[model samples]
Target: MKALVYNAPYDVSIENVPDARIEQPNDALVQITTTNICGSDLHMYEGRTAVERGKILGHENMGIVEETGPGVTRVQPGDRVSVPFNIACGTCRNCLSGWTAFCLRVNPVEGMDGAAYGYANMGPYDGGQAELLRVPHADVNLLELPPGTEHESDFTMLSDIFPTGWHGTELAGQQAGDSVAVFGAGPVGLMAAHSAMLRGASRVFVVDKEADRLALAESIGATPVDFTQGDPVEQILEATGGRGADCGVEAVGYQAHDQSGQEHPELVLDNLVKAVRTTGGIGVVGVYVPEDPEAADEGARHGRVAFDYGTFFTKGQRMGTGQCPVLRYNRGLRDLVIAGRARPSFLVSHELGLDEAPDAYRHFDKRDEGWTKVLLHPGQ
Candidate 1:
């Protein structure tokens, strides 16, 4: 099996690795068909996260199950399934409460309540960016696709970004006819804007400096705000008659920056605080780490951002932040796809074989033009 292995900062290679096998009684072995290179994966690829060398690095995955353990009764061999990025046990306290992202029984390390495949500080499970992947707790973790589901490229997004994007709007308390301002126009941000449109947002504004990404957002009916030209908050306010958007979503996370390429960890948060209307809700779906060794400053390295708490409190705004519970929203979103109501594959800019993953990583990490998203076909 050929897998994308992390070597060091700004380096990854496709190497022949041993095929994954069923290691647990509840496990299933999946022959991967479509896997994605996520923006979150770029954190590891850029050496911002503490991911070690030689580890496989993909989590957004969907494939055909080839074998299942005796305990797996619901899903069988030959079923097409989408694997959530989070690895959770079906019977944990958190799982029972619909918070699968914080499952207590999956991570082997003490004090760590959550786990994910191929993620640093998550667990020992390898990712699905190869010919074979080992899926633990298969029945609970895998979502079987509807029979004859032909949109593999679109269905593949249910594993992570689709649900994550929906979760962002949910966090922001977006309602029908409400206006939403979203920061960042990456895959997740684009999905967030699409979700807002699906949920009936009257107006959606996507802020980003990249021209290609902003164009993609516009194609999806979102108003594009190029921060390179002017202040994003001012643009949103000007468009909204100076009252600000009803809600705002910070999808750029801690790596946020200005048009000049200067890293400002709290830029989005401050922008959201001011861009959202008073007493409105704000959702943060972007990744913000407690420790970023490669941060631009010592304060950011320690996860300290000079946020505008005073303004946030005075505005009476509420916020929701953390990783998305993929399982909670995947089923409903899948149905929307099956009904042809949503097509996330529009964000995919490149589809390459497993051997081309190394180059794809480089281009995506740099946010190169026309490289909005990359999907890898391992079995190709």
Candidate 2:
């Protein structure tokens, strides 16, 4: 099998790997058709996370189930399915409660609570960035898509960004007619803005310095707030008549940068705190780890940044932070795609083959022009 393997910082390659097969009775073997190089993959690609060498590097995945174990009842061979990144056991306490992201029975690591494919410290599961993927708890995690490849690009998003973006809005408690200010114009950020629009936000502001991403945000009916022009919070406030936005979403995560392009771990958090109304809610869907050995800020190296907790407390704002439980939102989001109410494929800027994944990773990691999102067809 050919798959993208992470060797070191900024080094990934397509190499022949062992074939993926069913490892458990509840498992299914999927022939990966479409997978995306997600923003989260950059964390490992940039050496910001402890993603081990030789690990397959993709999570946003969808494909045809080539085979399934007898224990898998819902998903069957030849069924097109989208597998969520979080690999949860169906009977776990957290999974039963709809908190699939925090499933207690998946991660083998003693202290870890959840599991994911092809991620650092998440689990031992191989990812879908290859010709085939072995999916455990198949019935619990596989989302059956329409039989063919119609909306292939859109259905591929059901695995991650689309639902996670909607999770940002859910955490922020966004209501129809309320205004939203989203920090970062990456794929997730753009989706957050788009989700806000679908839910009827009166105004949506996307903050980013990248001309390409900001333009994409604007194309989605969001007001673009380029940080290089001025303080993003200030720009958002002015647009909201100085009252601040009714809600805010932080999609940039820990490796966030300032206006001058210097890395600032707390930049987005501070901006979100200041950009929303005093009593408004904020949702943080950005990835933040306990430590980053390559962090530009010394404090961030130890996962300690000077967050404005005092200001946050004074403002009486509420915040929700964590990974998105894809099960909670994907079904509805998938229906939105089928009904033509959502088209997340609009964010995909490149469609490359599995062999070209390394270069795609390089360009996407640098935040290069017109590289908002890159979808990889593994079998191509």
Clashing pairs in 1: none
Top-lDDT structure, candidate number: 1
lDDT of 2: 0.92
Q: How many clashes in each candidate? A: 0, 0
lDDT score of model 1? 0.93
lDDT of 1 by residue, 110-167 (tens): 6678899899989898988888999999999999996564998899999999999999
lDDT values for all models: 0.93, 0.92
Which runs in model 1 stand beyond 4 Å of their true positions? Answer: 147-149
lDDT of 2 by residue, 175-282 (tens): 999999999889999999989999999999999999999999999889999888888888888888899999999999998888667888888999889989999999
Clashing pairs in 2: none
Give each prediction's root-mean-square deviation over alpha carbons: 0.9, 0.9
